[model samples]
Target: MGISVEDEHGDEVDRIVAAWHLERPDLDTAPMSVLSRVTRLARRLDLERRAAFADQHLEPWQFDVLSSLRRAGEPYALTPGALMNELMVSSGTTTNRIDRLEREGLVVRSPSPEDRRTVLVTLTAAGRTRVDTALIALLECETRLLSPLTPEESHRLAGLLRALLLPFERPRTAGPPRG
Candidate 1:
């Protein structure tokens, strides 16, 4: 069966529009195809996520960086390179973010005993508390958003998403783009 409006949901339309322009020369495809809708819905989900984080006084990028370390367990720390990779940003950008988080007293830098040249970025007590609170609020917001869906449906959707992500989980060589 073709993808339905209910299945697509959110901002699927905009994503389709963007893709159509990019691949139109190669194929005559409708903008509202599967990938397009998924892109648009992702955009919409991002906006909602930002608003949810905003309610906790956290920027989306801030939450991303903070949460990554928080999920690291124990001391809640990682090297700057780790943060850069997780945030998918340039080294300079990650440095800037660390600087800002440091100023806000959310994170701190300490010398790595094994490698004096490397520094570990650890979440401060305050940072951990902030992320903990933000996480609770964020989960509550998500639960409410998905309230309309039955429990079985939610579980099924999550399984479907996991299945889709499985193929991309393994490491792969970098190469030229494929159509």
Candidate 2:
């Protein structure tokens, strides 16, 4: 058997898989066909996210913090501990984010109304505006990204992704994160 020629329908990963298959014929490279596309798509999406956030003068982490508070609805405040968990950052990191956002006047730290001992991170009006605007920009970019797919195809893709993600979303004995 000979190495496969580049096919018109193939993308970069297909070329890579062909090269790898020729080099290691004994190994099955089937998973690469699916996973490589997903990985590439994720990176592209992250770029779009960064561009959208940049337009709002926000970084991804800042958007993460502000969006969490915005999603909390009226008053848009959450305890620092709650923000730490929701943002999935260490308490110290959360503090640093809050400090930076506070400095920018996008958020404020105030004594919790229910428990004065606790501090709440509240989204400032500016924070709300920035996150909301950024969110709209992101969705527009994402919609364009998915424009090639039909609505049905998009729905099926979402279902497939959810199935793939379900196990990771569950609590289990912690494993080192996947690359």
Best by lDDT: 2
Error of 1 at 89 (Å): 2.0
Candidate 1, 1-179: lDDT as tens digits: 23333445535554445455465646656634555656766787788888888867898889889999999998899999999987889999999999999999999999987898999999999999888888887888789878989999999988987876666654566543343
**Which segments of candidate 1 are over 4 A away from where they belong?**
1-31, 174-179
Clashing pairs in 1: 11-40, 12-37, 16-36
- TM-scores of all predicted structures: 0.76, 0.89
Measured over all alpha carbons after superposition, the RMSD of each candidate to the real structure, in angstroms, is 5.2, 3.2
Candidate of highest TM-score: 2
lDDT of prediction 1: 0.81
